[model samples]
Structures are given as structure tokens and as C-alpha cells.
Target: MALFLNTPKLNYWIPKLIEESEEELILIVPYIQTSKNVLNALNKADSNGVEITLVYRENKLSDYEKSKLLALKNINLLHHPNVHCKCYYNGDLLIVGSMNLYEYSEKNNREMGILMNRIRFKGQETFASRMVNDRTDVFDDAILEIREIINAASLEKASKKAKQTAFKIDIIKTEEDIVRDRCDRLNISFLNKKFRTVEYLDNKWFAQCENFFDKVDVVFQTHRIEITFRLEQNELYNLYRAWMQTYDLYEFHGFKYYWNKPDQELLVYKHDNFDWSTDNADCNKDKKYYEGLSTIIKKYRKITNK
Candidate 1:
């Protein structure tokens, strides 16, 4: 038996549809300006872990409305541009209607709907495969159609939480991002290269070269960068010999050989500054050339025996 409903009945029964659901619910609404009672019922269903799938046309929604619905925890919301049919199902009952699940339609418009029992086969009445216009519009068929609609849509911002995943939207790069980028520009083996921070008194950034005692560390002071390295005395002489053969000590920043009496340690320092933005070409010469200071360091850092 099919029950015909006027606007007042639609207003009452839609929330009832959400309330009466035990296992699953599916709603396909084209313009979803759902009433407060309707939203409340859906929220209740979501809190109870009722599996729900909702399909609607995004072009008809306000920005706030779209965000409010997308914030729900358990409802799988989707968009389909070609759908205007309004369907509400709660496993056992199905309502197909001219009503849009819109508050204005329920309060003012002369809307109408038809509710029927969704039985697969009961005493020869097969509501699941109901015959209409020489075709079967099965209750299960709409479920499949909703699934297809979901599959066709991109899910990047579909919910920000389609499956309870944390999403980061900060596109701007940080100081750490810049440091890592410079490390990448160095001509070194990517698998063996690594960089990190040293948080002692003043925080500093350091890059490891193939797991050796000597490391390239950068200290950003105001706008100036103080590049430092620690190595043995013999390693410094070995590097300086090869470096002078091609370039001068000016390009080595301020490299020196500690030869006072019997000093043991070799420490190198270079002070410079540049535009720290993503314009890496201005900051560091990524290409092999006699262009930036970084290129000079990259060429000579590996020439030593240690």
C-alpha cells in the first residue's frame, strides 16, 4: 500500500525517516536547505554510527551550508550536477517526492510525496523491483546509482574528513623548509645526505655530508648566514691545496689553515646573506658553475681525502 503525503506530512515524515533508521540511510537531494529538525535527526544518526550516504548538487548550496554538512563525522557527502530527484530511504521505507527537503518548500510550497514499503518480496508484492513505465526501479538500484555518483567525484576537499584523515592546508614555506631546500641544492648523494636542527642556547641548522665528522652548519643571524664547519687540520690543508688550484680564498668565504705553534683543530667560517624565498637561483647556484657561493662550496667540500 502506498501512502500519499501533502507538504505538512513531508515536513513531519522526513525527520521521522532519519529517526526510524536502524542500520543504514541514503538521501539524494538536489537542493538541500534542510530544516533544523532534519539536521538534528541526521546528527543523532551520525552519533549512533548509522551508515549514511548523501548526494546533492553543490551549485545550489551556500558556502556556510556546504561547510556545515561537510563537518559531519559519519555522513559521506557527494555532488552530482545531473540529479534533481529527492529520495529518502531507511532500509525498510522509501520516499520519492517533489519535495526538495528544503525548509521553504515544506513551509510555503504545495509539495507532495509518496511513501512505500521497501520489501524485496512479500506475499507476491515485490516493492524492490517495482515495475514502472515498462522498467524496474529497484530500491537497491538507487543505492548502486548513489555509489556510482560517489565514485565519479574527486575527494580532495569533499569533506576534508571523508575518512577521518588530518589535512594540512598551510601552503607557505617555513624557515625549516628553506634550510631543507638549500640542503637539496648541494651536489651530494640524496640517499646519504641529511639535515637537522641543533637546539642549544641559539638554535642552528646543520647538514650532514655522507655521515662524516665534518658537517656544514648554518647560523641565521638577523639576515646574515654564518656557515661553519669542523674538520681535522690535515683535512683543511688537503682541501685548501686543491681549492687554490682552481679558485681563490675569497670564494671559500674565509677558510684558513690553523698553523700557530701546534694548534690541532680546523674551523672554517663564511658570512653572507640573500633572498631566502623560493627563488633558489638568486640564493644558491643549483647548476654547476662559478655563479653563487654555494656552488663553490659544493665543488670543494668533497675534494679532501678525509
Candidate 2:
């Protein structure tokens, strides 16, 4: 059993534990916005058929985030509102810490924690079982119920509604028409779309998209126009790292990344502040905003694809 304290070790240790896993990978972080490399490692574990279970706080995850996580395979995602413990474990190791999966902690925060090798604890085999089979509180149960609803509903319906609401003007036929036409003109594959509003089904919606390198989506709302990259796991970390090295981070004001693992979004918004309430919104006026975003998306796609 070894302990890692304030050593920027999780970036190395977490992935190492994931890489060494043979059966399952469990991560329990209250808040998350992990780096791309770490996300890639998690995705790789999933691709290899590792049963990945994530226990996180529901309050911190957005609907867009919930939808993306529900899209993955061989993973069990549980949300507990009051959960603040950060515990990570696989078949052979257990890591618990003050660190979150958030990029801020991994990259910038002075966080501290401990990593224990389970094998060294020999006769105390119940340690892993206890961590895995821990009991859930009432909040956890409530989140599970909500999660079932979000995961079951298709994202297409949400996208259609967003399109209807955003492009309700007679000039547009359907949301799909605009998105499809734009994709066709750009020679990009139409993947999936996602939508969320404070009012709808606990603010959850999902859409299906093609598996392409281009993963960003143009999210149109009454008060804001956002170009968001919906990434699964480590793609954001990898891409963000590259973007930071190449682009001037300070210049892209509202452009940043957020992750809760399995559900990550890298986004830039036309407006930093938003009045998300329905009464304060005017989707009709955002035509020019959307056009500007389309141009940005096109350029971003080219840069990332290259």
C-alpha cells in the first residue's frame, strides 16, 4: 500500500491503475472535468471490455453531460448528490483522495491524497469489496431514478424540439434541415444532436450522431449561442492540451472545457452570461450569432481534423 501526496501523481497513477486493470475500473469523484489523456485511458479501458463504474455527484452534472455518459457501453454511472469522497479502484489498486477528476485539480490545484496497492493488504480482501459495495443514500436513489429516464429517452426528440424552438421562423423547415444542410455544405458527417432546457424532463435530452472526428455541436438557446464539443472521456483532454499549446488560451474568453468523465464538453459561447429562464430568451435574434458560430465550427473542425 503506497500513498501519493501533492505530487501531480494522479495524472500518472490513475491511468497506470486503469491500464493495469483486468476486470473492472471504478472511479468515484464528486466533481469532474478530467484531462484528455486520462479520459483516453478510461475510454481505452472501456473499449477493452472493462466494466467501468462511475459514482459521482448528480448536482454537478449537466443534462448534456448526463446524455453523453449514458451513450457509453459496459459502464455503470451512478449519481449521488451528497457524495464528496474521491475514491478510485480497479482489481488490484485503490486510490482515494482530496483530488477531483476535474482538470483544475489535475493541472492547477494543490491537491493531496493517498493511493493504496490492494495486494499489499493481503488478508484484508474485504477492503475492495467494501468500497465497491458501499451503500447509497436517499439522494443517490433519487438520481438513479432520474438517470433511467434520461438514458431511455432518445436524443433526437430533444434535438428536434431545440430546432423547433430555435428556428421557429418560417424560413426554416426543421432543425434537421439546417443542421443537415450545414453538414452537407461542409462535407462533414451528421453525427448526433443533444438539447436541454431547465423545463424538459429534468433538463435532459439526447440525439444520435455519426462516429466522426468532428464532435462539436452548435447549441442554440434563447439567450446564448454555444459551440460545444461533446466528448466521451479523454478526447477533450488530448484536444485541449493541443489547443492550449497552439492557440492563445487567454484570448478565447468563454472558450473552455468541462468534464465529469464519460461526459465532457469543450465549449465557447457568444455571451458569457446567460438568463436561462424561458421568459428572458429570444432565439429569433440569434441568426447572425449562429452564422458566426458555424464559421468558427468549420475552422475548428479543420484545425482538429488536421
Candidate 3:
């Protein structure tokens, strides 16, 4: 059987579906803004001991929205980075169409939805089991990684450029060296210059030595690290582009690039767009060049221990 409903008309069937659902409710929506109807439906489902899983895009959630969603015990608000489909699956029943959860989509915009009560399955297993098996945790570690990138981007946007170069550099001769000889050199230089202590993070030793190691500034990838200092806006961009050229790094598509003037920090990242072509020699050359360039920066920036 087929059923049709408009936005204002959703209230009629929505509550009925929630009341009848016994196993699970899977909601797939592209965008979710704050709305009373959506929240109320979710709350009702939660109170009924239904396992609610919402898959939506990973846009920044407002403080209010975060707080409201956090209060719900059973609601699972997940990030679906590639989610573009809109549908509702309640056990064996599947509703597919263009209708969104928003009031406008429901009440004003032209919308349509299909309600399928009995689905035919190709295998011996039931249709509900198949649908559940297709379910994925679209909001786990990937979301956390994306959040870290977003946080770093925010910091990059707010920092001011240094009036003078304040970055410390380090260099090592061999690729297998455990200790950062470059940082050791930087420590001596920093002591002589009396620059404030900056934390350093190192990968080779898997160690974070503070004050003892001249309080190394943040430790980073064994191959790449970032140091922030003040520079003119144009100078900063020039330096960044020069740095990129030092490695001949080609720009990745869809990556968001940002620079903070006050902090003199530049960040270029779009984890999703990164494509390291293992098959393409040119890409490898480009990658090697960039790695070499980072090595060069570390070599010169370090205050030589000798």
C-alpha cells in the first residue's frame, strides 16, 4: 500500500510510527537544525526505550544543540560525512523520499515519501536483518579525527603573525636517528637568546621531554612539524608557498587552507581530499621533494649543538 503526506501532515503518522516501532529507528537526513518537532519526536522515541540512531552531516553543532542532544540517554547523534540520502527505516518498514525533518520541508516545500510495509528479500534471511546489516558506524573515530582538524583550523584562524621569526629549527643527518639533533641545537640557541620555553613533540623516541630537554616545543611527526611566529601577512604567505615549493607539494582538491595573521600560523588540510598516489612516480617525487624540504627547514632552524 502507498501513503502520501505533506509537511503539516507528518505529525499525524510520525507519532504512530514511533509508537509501533519495536526494534530500531534509523534516521538519515542531510542537515539537522534545531527544531521542536524533531526534538519532540526523538524524545518520545527515547522514552519508549527505542534505540535511536541519527545519521547527519558533521557541521559544527551550536552550544544549545549540543546540550539538548547530550541530555538524551538513548539518542545517538552520528556524523555521516558522506551521507546524502534521506529516508527512515523502522524495522521491516522502509520510508524513502525527499521529505526532510525540517518544518519548511514538511509544511511548505513540495515533498513526497513512500511507506513500504512488506519488503521482498532475495535471500532466506528477512529484509529487516539485511537492512540492519547494511548499517555502519558512520560517526566513530573518523569524526574525532575531523574534529581535531577543525580545532586546529580554528586556532590557525585566530593567531597573529610574529613581528620577528620566533621559530626554532633542528636538523639530523641520518633518517634512522632517534634523537632530534636539531632540537638540541635549538635549545642552546634558545638559552643564548633567552626565548620563552616552547614544548616539543618527537616521534622517534616516542618521548615528550619538557624543561629537561630545554623544554622542547610541541613534538610532531618525525618527518614534519610546524612552528608559529610573527611575520607580515604577505611574508607569511610567501614563506608558506616557498615551503610548499621546497617539497613541490601539489595542492589537494577540496582542502581548506587558512592562515592566522595574529598567530602567524598557516594550516592546509582536508583529510578527505588527500590522495597519495602510490602508482604514480611523479606523485612520489612530489612527496619526496616535500619531505626533503621539511628536512631542510628543520636543518636550518635548529640551533646547532656543535
Candidate 4:
């Protein structure tokens, strides 16, 4: 008898499918959204040279989402308007699932699915072969019909009116002005050679530094310290939290930390950049400042392995 059960925790089966898959993998999800984990899994399969065929609702894709999908070399995004089923097939193992391959559905939300193993039989062999042969032809015809509708709509005037509008602007500021105005306020050093070098080169590091500080509470001993920065996905926040807990240390100089929200603006520190002099002997006398700064730098360096 075939086993039937509620397939909650869909991610648990992905690794299994990935491991056992040999000849081909077919995924049919109506709504396709990209996430870091999903991309990683797909890339892993691609690295192993798995033949992946994806069918999704093309009309639902946003402009940015389409760009991301198009960037993948091996993955082909087929437009299937009538496709509402969420199914995964690896060889003879077929999985029908209620969960979409999205972050909320796969990670937090409660969802369910079912797994079925199809067997090959002598009498049904011809039927199965015919189904396999006709699969692409039938799916392609449906997809082409939808694409024609989309192309026709694109030529309409109202379609042009409904399109999203965007614009770009540039801001100019001098280094000395920025340091005097912003760094001095945050009590961060702005004079270090390293600080000046990293100020403008894709400040993702500064963003991560800010996030690290906000996610944890810290006590600082140093008045001034240099901090390095890097941008990482929000999912890695747990790893950072674990690292901080293990070390019992925090506080880094780079930027001000913000609240833990996806859309929250990054808090910029007044002392975002600083220049300190060794010749200033009186400034070095503050033991708390030196110790606190040293601790912050050391912890950051350890976390980044820099």
C-alpha cells in the first residue's frame, strides 16, 4: 500500500530530493519568489549539473523578479498561466505540496504536502512514455498562448501608463565637511588612514556593523576604535547572535546600530570616521577608552576572521 500523510516542513524533503535526484528534476510552482536559501539550493543543483525544469505564472512576476530569474544560466522560467499546482518530481518520486517555495511558507508559516512514488509496469510503460513525450508539447502550447496575451497587452497604451516610474539623483559632499559634521557628533575617530580608505567603497560593511550593534547590547571601554564592515544576508543574523553570545563581547566603531526591522534605515554615527594621533600622549591616558576600543576591534576581527 502507498503511504499517505500530511507533509509539513517541506524543507526537510528538499535535501533528500537533492541527494537522490539523478536524471531530471521538475518543479511546478504557480508563484515563484527568490530568497537566499532558495538560490543557494538551486545553485547547488546546478553545480552538480542537474537538469532542472521550472514552470511558473509569468504574469505574476515583477520587473525586478524577472531580471533575477533571467540571470540564471541553467534555469529556464516557463510561463504557464493555468498552472496553479505546486509539485516537485525527482525521478519516480513525486511530491504535491500546498507550500509555495517562499520564505514565509517554507520557514515560518504552517503548510503541508504529500509524496508519491510511481512504479514502472510492463502494461503501463507505453502510457507513461507517451505522457513523458507529450508533456513539453502540451505545457509549451499553454505557455505560448499566455505569452501572446502578455505581448499584446504590452503594446496597449494603458499598459504603458500603468508601468512603474523611477528616477536617479546625485549628492555631493566634501570629506572634511562630512567628518566635522557627522563623525565628531558620534564620538567616532575620523583621522585613521584605514577609516579614510574605506569610507566610500560600497559601505555594506558599515551596514553589517550597525546591524550587529543593534541586535545585541554591549559595554564599551574604549572612546575610539576602528571598525571594518561587510554586508551579509539577514538570515545570517542568527550566526552573529550565537557568536556574540559565546564571546560575551560587543561594540564596534563604524556606524550607529538600528532596530531589527527589514525596512529600517541604517543609523549613522556622529563618529562614523575618525583620525587619531599617537603624538597625543594625554589622549592615550584614558585606560577605559583604550580597553573598550580594543575589545570592540578584537571581537569584530574574530567574527570576520580578518
The top-ranked prediction according to TM-score is 1
- In the range 1-306, model 4's lDDT, one tens digit per residue, is 222334343676654554445545666677767666666766677667565556666587677766765555445456665667776665445556686666666667766776555332222343223322222223333334433433333221211112332110001112223333333323343122112212333221111123233333222212223232333556346435644465421233422343233233222232324333442343342233434445554665567555
Q: Could you give candidate 3's per-residue lDDT for residues 187-294 as a string of tens digits?
A: 443333222222242212311223222312223233333334344566556555555443323342333334444345434342334554442453443344334334
Local distance difference test scores for all models:
0.56, 0.51, 0.44, 0.44
Alpha-carbon deviation at 54 in model 4, angstroms: 0.6
Q: Please, what's the RMSD in Å of model 1?
A: 23.0
What's model 1's lDDT at 125?
Answer: 39
Residue 22 of candidate 2: its Cα lDDT?
Answer: 59
- TM-score for candidate 1: 0.44
Name model 4 segments beyond 4 Å from true.
1-8, 118-306
Task: Give the RMSD in angstroms, all C-alphas superposed, for model 3.
Answer: 20.7
